[model samples]
Target: MIYLNQAGYAPNSTKRATITGNNHYNLFSADGKKILSGECTLEFDENSGENAAVIDFSEVTEEGRYFFADEDNFRSPEFVISKNHYDQALRDSMKMFYFQRCGMELEEKYAGVYKRKACHCGGGYILGDRFQRRKMLGGWHDAGDYGRYVTAGAVALAHLLYGYEMFPGALTLNLNIPESGGSLPDILAECKYELDWILDMQDEDGGVHHKCTSASFCGFIMPDEDDLDMVITPVSSLATADFVAIMALASRIYHKFDEPYSNTLAAAARKSWTWLIKNPSFIFENPKEVTTGTYEDLCDADERFWAAAEMYRLDKNEDAMKVILGTMELHLSMHCLGWADVAGLGTLSIINSGTDFFGKDLYNRLVMKWLDEADRLKLISQSNAFGITLRPIEFTWGSNMVILMNAMILCVAHKLTGDDSYLKSAQYQLDYIFGRNAMDLSYVTGIGERAFKHPHLRPTAADNIDAPIPGFVSGGPNFRPCDEAANPDNMSDVPAMKRYADDVRSYSTNEITIYWNSPLVFVLGYMNSL
Candidate 1:
């Protein structure tokens, strides 16, 4: 399979690039006639091997259907060079969050092709402290498992909120969710659905429980069918901190749409923030009996930073702003936005929060710091064969989220600096994920000609349909293939970019998660605006 941008590209945008060892290639009309032929320039990287082929279709300004072809491979899927190549993709990606909703019936009227049974309705209990049973009804099922984890859900929801915050104009596409034509944007409405679930996960004292899951992973069955010992586990400072950040953010955004809900969220945010402040070092350890994704965070500094930064945004507490600023100074460097580490979220909230809480000069300094970091990643991406930012060392679990987050950083930088290079790099990152990389597969479901079909997601496994749910991005290539679904013979010695297997058993490379799909929605939304 040859990878092109599955969302297509604009005629005036950056030249399209793809990986191919072959020396000759052709651009074909939709009718299978060669319109242009050229000798390929083989760029090589010691780390990523031979760079992909680059195609400059910028001169083809006529808006019409086209594709790529070579002597060795079959014809590529038809793509269009129009002004709105990414609009529908942005819509579908946002709808994925709706498909992931738990404890709610996916009625056929709203969720057309992705409807399913209601699940996880029964509340749960603390594992060791089983006597402390709490009502845990809502939120998304994390990854392929039928579990709802606070830290993981917070990260996904925060990223989705960031997307909405940064690109509100672009994300206004109607997703036909249950609240489709409501006053709130469809993206926010979908997020609010999960946010409501998140609210339910919180205890009376505002220390959010770490996760709600069965003692062991459920069988590869539908969510409604998974009937194990569902229990809500212990609360932790990390979960509370992450919860505070998301709630504060939700409170701010939801205020314009639903003031009463917004007020409730704000109160919850304050309570969670207070809980974290009082118990700063209350780390979370998975109870012995439970064996789900622990999402354990040993250090709470990033979570603390994020929570305080968000609280500053909502209420502007002087002490919270001071602590957030100090935390920013201490950790000037940013890591990939993930469930465990959230310093980047703290940093982004500060940059976009519109409050010169640290003074104008300090805020300017912070923006410069962020743009500089993004520039560093851009340089690496620009130098790579496929123009992807991730290095071989970065291909750990959930690598797709890291790659998408890198693109998101580029998008944020573009918004801040008006640098075309940043936007161009982000586009290339999208291209890489969709099909332009070594694997020659679109990581998203039901998009490319050779898109991911078998994800580790339970609904996909249980559904009668042949394809997985559309627009759900898979956990891309991982160097350490550690899941039971991982086929050792196919992955043991492959290159970093080539390590992905489309097989359903390859959980490390094939599972779908909200965090992975969230940035995809953000990036697609941004690209549609472009």
Candidate 2:
């Protein structure tokens, strides 16, 4: 079988595919006319423990639909080589957030066949005090569940707003959401839905709730069908700090369109900054009775650094700058742009602020650190058969997000330095998500010839639609299958790359999260802009 990007490739991009045993390959047009032929070079893939015949057809730059045929009679899925190859996928991925919106009726005009009534619209009671109800009406559902979490939502927003900031041209398309004709771009408008909810999560004291969820996970049912009581979890330093960072960033982005709302965000950010400074070590844990997702973190240093960095970027506050300088080494050492560790996001904000804010010496240092990480990821991609930056141990839960995030880092490196190598590495990572893996599966739903269909999302499972909602990214390939549904028939013993089950019961591997899709949007937005 040929493993390549089923979503296709950009015409001038490096086009490569891997076959298990075939040593020769031919690229054919839609009508079976041969366009290019190449001899495959054999490479040992450590993840799959197989010798892969790698096909490199980078010379095929014409805009047309094509496929590969191997000597062993295996024909690859048809894919397009065009400048607009990623346009549909990018739009679908962005529209995914609109589909995930809570507390609002999804009109048929916007949602089409997936349209549904408003869900979870009732005000949520404070977890410890049932009598105290707060209006928690909007925001995208955090993941496969109906929960809304601050840390996750903030990280997801960072990906999106940063994408808009860096590539405004790509994200300016009309997504046909309710805010389609608004003054702000549709991307920022869609994000404001969640931003409003995030603001509501902040208490009078400025601390933000960790999450708003039921006491436990509900059965698989439509969002409106599930009658579970929503409870607002207690505030944590992590949530507060993340809230500060994202609110600060959003304030800047929304300032041009809505100065009043932007000022509200800035005020909210400052309040949260105060809360973070006062309650510096407040880490949240799930109360004994609550059985929902915890999102508990052991340390809040990175969150504080990110919050401080954003606050600094917002107004050049000296206190925030002092915090950034104090945590500069720790921020530089951190490599991940995940929910748990967001110092990288803070670094990005600082880097984007330019050397005028931070001295030239410090700016150069940060640039060097980013380039060095990109260089390391490039080497890792070269060493692998799929040309992705995942090590064997890195194929844990939510591994697909890791792939996209690595691609995001490579994209940033490309922008920092005009080296085409970084961009190529980023494209390879996108290719892996589209197909180009041992499973021959596109990790995104409804996007490719063999996209994964069953996501662990409750609404999709209960919608009765034959296909899951489009553009929600699957977690992908967890070596340690935590659920019995994922480990059926001793499937956990398979190679890490093939350990994925398409079962909706396999939440560890098959679940889709807002943050996961956000990076996909960022990467796709960047590619489309190019």
Candidate 3:
């Protein structure tokens, strides 16, 4: 029978008892491949014995075919039920993963740049860490077209996980938006427009030449930051680019799911993939992402890689999993010793796979690695090493991003390994977050150590908790929460709850980020769906 995709795994071992007459079972396929387990004389009897109480012996004398068992469901063997429990457990995880998305907020956008009335200008789709940083004295500082591009890409991802993807919400595929959402010819025109504007802006080598550009869509000028410049370089690996690419790819993925336009998406996939592959910010040593960096500022490269695994499943290319698995192994092997959580991102897609190394052991190792890093000093990455070495609050966003993700990872690990310790560790990390965040979703503006709230600021594409952020008014955002000497006046602030005014959360961050929102959604969805 066609069982739901869930309920596949089952107890592997079962004892076969002889029914006095029939001890044969045959399995056949429509095409004609049939299997017979030969003939073995029945042995044990279920009548009037220790086993008699456990099994029914009423049909003891019948000599005929019995029942059979498959992956998700079975008929004969009572011993094989345990194997399927894991699948049930995984489905239940949807509870946590689904709830995670609730944190994301939609950002209204404007069609044109330079709106005199910033408030009444236009509406944006979603807000991510991309827009949270560049605050200027006169207005909300923007990184220009790059910012818009980043948003466009991120919103796509948000929608993808919000249940728009054709494949499972993993493989990071994308679409090249048409120039205009019009007729077929007009669609081509729109495609040309987007391609011309975005592609032309890149240098001959396919990278943004200027770190800071003007935003035609938002009417603002972007700031030139050192790291932003470092990322577009062909030689270095960056987390920022990968994270932003999620938006574009996710948008296309969602659209494809909505319409089943396989060929159209395939056509648009190349350039975007090219951009991701060639970008320096994303470390790809050993044919996988290797180098690790600030979790907050840089876009994660592996996020797309993780998304690709699910894509392979949907396309049934099976070959694609080779790309997904091989590259991921390369990353995991290279990243195992590092404390940066960015590397762990590559492990996400592998969690549900059934390969030799990936089925179990490898997952456990990753959780252990993250725990070691979070628990120790040298193991911690530069971004997470705040409040002590490495600029105190530099990676406030990154640090928490690492912690929250690792927690989810730990929870999954616990289920797979049957180890409660891992779950304990996951809970600890969540508690670690509450230590500062007040367990509240609002950190908008008027909130603080206990009353931090910044609801007014817009939410970005990546969930703020998971993505890089410059942070709010409290004290830390750009690597440091309270970078006194570096930024004497700079401080991170907690955002207030805009939606739940009566339930004003004293610990929430200001805006909801897409990346941050995705993980939360994933954790709850994975947990609750079970």
Candidate 4:
């Protein structure tokens, strides 16, 4: 979405100026220029009588100027072209949280990499522990600490537009600003405490110890005397998928920005990806072995697909291609058990595989499955006896799986294979999502249903938070990713969601969600080919 240069992150290509009219303001660039409105069909002329604004790139003579989004002048008309493109990049990020929902001015916080779920102009940036903030990505760093791993991904993204900046010790990376304004670790160059701790929890083989964390980082010092008040944890499930999800995210950013991939970081992700692909289980008994468990216990669908998809982006290997195609088929076909029943969410991941596996029969098969499946399921509704879905359980609760991922998948499928049916499916979701946006006509509320809400910051400590956790433990590579893991049924118990709007609400923050954004980038990316 952002015009990252050939060299990764900020390149000489973006130095030139460009223009972005307020044509699609309400729909695309909502809030920031909310008053500016125009139809797509509006003809452009000197006196079009519409919002006629232009981003003049006339000052640029070189490539670097074109790719760079000068922060000091970020809101300048001179950098309009690059800004509009960069703003489009926010579509994916917006899914996670509507960055500009109500605020007229864009917050500098959302300008960089964000790790929170809902950062509308009103709320600023709020960190959400993945499970508590599952509507958001529900990944490892969802806990909202604004730590190092998050910083790495943020830095990589910022590099594409704003290279490492003036902030020292920002929460996210050098490129990204943190909630607390601290610099995060470069997960690519080196594995941070979070990854290492999670890694230590796993066996040398690929089986991930459900909630047990691996302390791969330095010397193990016990917590300070002050930590006695903390609730210790153990046996928490560390999702292999979560690890891969972050890797995939960073991978996409790095690839876009043209940053050199670090060996340790890359190898760690490669190992996780290879193991997950080979074993393909959600439960990580050992990092090497992801054996089957309760269907709901597997890592999030988004993480798995990203693992495969990013690998394809990086290597373009048939093996990785096979893995993505096969995984999507498995979930779509027979895996429609508990949470897996809701068919639409996985569409993005599945269709992403289709796009990557372009020209291949397998890609077509996956797309066909989406069309056929949509027909079989009908529509996503909990009140309806036969809601358009393979499994009712997944459809019952308001897990984001039904809203964000479903629309994303449909659109992606349509984009990958130019079948009108795929477009229809995407429209089906857009119809519902956009309808809600029109109804509220204000901010971007979640689409479809309301997912369960857990505590953003739990009462338990790093050690105590783990399921079947041990007691009285403190300190050492203090972060834990197990909380990001959730069961399929977690969707069903959201009592509070019952009070929210229907299955289709405003487009769930299609602003910050990696799952939603990656597919958007891929789909628009492919469509742009035309």
Candidate 5:
């Protein structure tokens, strides 16, 4: 079996594949013509305990459909080599957000056969004060379940906003949503849908609610069919800080299109910032009897750091600067871009500010640290058999997010240093996502030749559609499977990378989330830009 990117590659990009045995291989066009031939080199992969034969066909730069054939008549999946190879995938990934919108009816015209009525549009009762209901609607569903979370939404929005900031030309595609043809790009318009909901999550006291969810996850049903009572949970520093960071960033991004709306976001961000200063450490816990997705974090320092950095960027606030320097002194986790550890987003904001708001020395220090982390990920990709940057221990839940997050870092590093090596490593990470892994499965729905169809998304499961909504990325391989479908009983001897089940029941390994697809959008946008 040969593993390569089933989604194809850029014409001038690095193209490689991994097979099990060493042999002379021939690259054949869609016709019977041979394009190139290469000898595969055998090397022992310590992580997978396999003798992998690696093929490098980077020199084949012609635009055409092709496949690799070995001496044993093993033919790899057909892929295309072209400059615009990733354009559709990038558009689909971004459009997935439009499909995930909560309160709006998905008309058949825009959503095709997967249309549904507006869901969760009713005003939600506050968790404690059941009689006092507030109109809490809009924003994409947090994950497979129909919950709406602030921290998750903020990080996901940050990814799209930052991606647009980096590669505006690539992300300016028309998504054909209801908000298409607006002054703002469809990307920002879609993000504004969530931003509007996020703004509602903020309280009069300036603190943002952690989430608005049912007491328990509902059954596998369409969003409108899940009739459980949705309640707004109390605020947390985590949510408030993340809300401030993303809103501040959005204020600047949307200013050119709508200054009044931008001012609203900026004011909300300042209010949240004030709340963060007063309440230094309010970690949210799932209230008793409310058992929905608890995005609980032990520390809110990174969240605060991201908030301060973004606030400082919006307006050179001296207090925000103090928090920034102070957080840097604490040496928080700066390499991770996950919702739980968002110091990297703060670092990114500071680095992208382009003005030495933190002083030239501190700015340079942050750049070097970011590049150093990217270098580490590049080396890991180089050493791995599949050219992915995953270690055995890193195959936790939502591992694909790790892969794409690393790719985002590498792409940014390439942008900063203009080094093709970083970009090449980033391509390898994307290749792993497409179909260059042990399972030979594309973790995204409706992508690649053998894409995983059954995601743990409630809408896909209950919509009665044969195929899931395309472009929803599955939470890839979790060695310590937590769902019944992928539990230890059935996956006792499976390798870490192969410990995935494409079943609706395998929520641990198969659930899809907005945040998961956000970095994918960022990475694909970068690739398309190149």
Candidate 6:
């Protein structure tokens, strides 16, 4: 199996393909003519422990479709070299959010073969607040499960918005959502679909519910078949803080197009921030009755910092700035820019907000801090056999998101410093997802020829389609195998990078989520713009 970018490579760029096994390979143009100057090398892979054959086409700069063939395999997938490489991919990745919408019918025209009946229309409860049992309806389904989580949704939205905010007109494409070619950009329109539900999750007092979920995980059935009671879980600091950040961010974007709606978002954000101030220490724990996904975060200083950063950006609140700066000393110790730990979010908000609250020198330092981290990750990625940004420890659940987040940070670094290397590294990470790394499979469904067909998606399972829903990105290559369903694959004893199984039961590697797709959208849109 050979892995090359599905959308192809750019001319005069370093173009390479990975194949497993010890053998020489020859690059061939679409016309079956030898294309490369030198022989390929088969080296031991540190990431997968496989005899990784690397076919380098960096020196072959002609812009044309080509493939590799040798004794170890037949013909590899065809790839091209052109400037507009990721154009179609960018559109497909953005359209994926349309498939993840909850409480809505996926019409045949928009969803194509992935269309489904309306589901999860049942409203949610407020759990234990004064407005306990109050109605909250309509949000994105978290992962393959029929649940709506605030923390995950907030992180996803913030990244998507950041992508839009950072590169103007990047997400300007019409995604063919219900609001395509509307007054608002299609990205914000799709975001509004989720925001409406998020607003419903917020209480009158400004606190946001942690999640709206069923009593238990839904069976391997369609959304319409899942009849469990939908209930809103208790409010938590993580959820409210995330809410504050997303709402404030959304308010800023919507203000330009829809002033009235922007005011509503701003008011909700302010209200949530007030509630967070009073209950800053509140931690959310799932009730014993609820057996759904718990997006629990124990330490919420980062979450608070994220919310404060956004709040300060929106209103220039001195208190918010003080809180953000007070947390700055602890920010350097932060890890990945993942949904779980949003320390990077606060830092990014400060860097992009254009507020001199932290002073110019400090702001410049924060920018350097992020770029330095990207530089370190880039070095690590470049050394790996697969050339992925993920370290050994990052191969946990939702590892694909981790990789995409790395690309997001690298893109930010590129924007800050105008460094071509950072942008190129970012594009390389995106290439890995589109099928240019270990496993030789595109983590995104229905995109590349070798993409995953059996994602752990409810609609895909029930729709009985031969192919999974297009554009849904799987949680690729989980090194730490946790699911009993995935144990039969014998991946637990395998090397970290080689532990992935494409089985539908392998939720660790096969599950799809909005958060994962969100970062993909951000990176793809940014790359597409370039």
lDDT tens string, model 1, 1-530?
A: 24577667787887575646676778887877777877767766543455555666677766778888777875776778888777766777788888888888999888776678888777787777767766677677888888888898899998888878887888887887788888998888888878887887777888888888898998888888877867888888888898899999998888889999999999999998888777866767888888888898788888888888889888878768767767766764554478888888887887786646656875687688778878988998877767788888788888888889999889989988898999988988888777777777778887767677888887888777786878889888888887666665766767788777777777888889888988888788788766
- List clashing residue pairs in candidate 2: none
Worst 10 contiguous positions by lDDT, candidate 6: 126-135
Taken over the whole model, the C-alpha lDDT of each candidate is: 0.80, 0.88, 0.30, 0.30, 0.89, 0.80
Model 5 scores a TM of 0.98
Evaluate model 4: give its TM-score. Answer: 0.40
Who is ahead in lDDT, 1 or 5? Answer: 5
Model 2 per-residue lDDT tens digits across residues 163-236:
98898899898999999998989999999999999999998889899899889999999888868999998899
Question: How many steric overlaps are in each model, in order?
Answer: 3, 0, 135, 84, 0, 0
- Give me the candidate number with maximum lDDT: 5
- Give TM per candidate: 0.95, 0.98, 0.39, 0.40, 0.98, 0.95
What's the TM for model 1? Answer: 0.95
lDDT of 6 at 221: 92
Residue by residue across 43-77, what tens digits does model 6's lDDT show?
77666777776566688778888887766666677
Residue pairs with backbone overlap in model 5: none
Pairs with backbone N, CA or C atoms under 3 Å apart (clashes), candidate 6? none
Candidate 3 TM-score, C-alpha based: 0.39
Candidates' RMSD to native: 1.9, 1.3, 19.8, 16.7, 1.2, 2.1
User: In angstroms, how far off is 388's CA in candidate 4?
Assistant: 10
Candidate 6: Cα lDDT at 185: 91
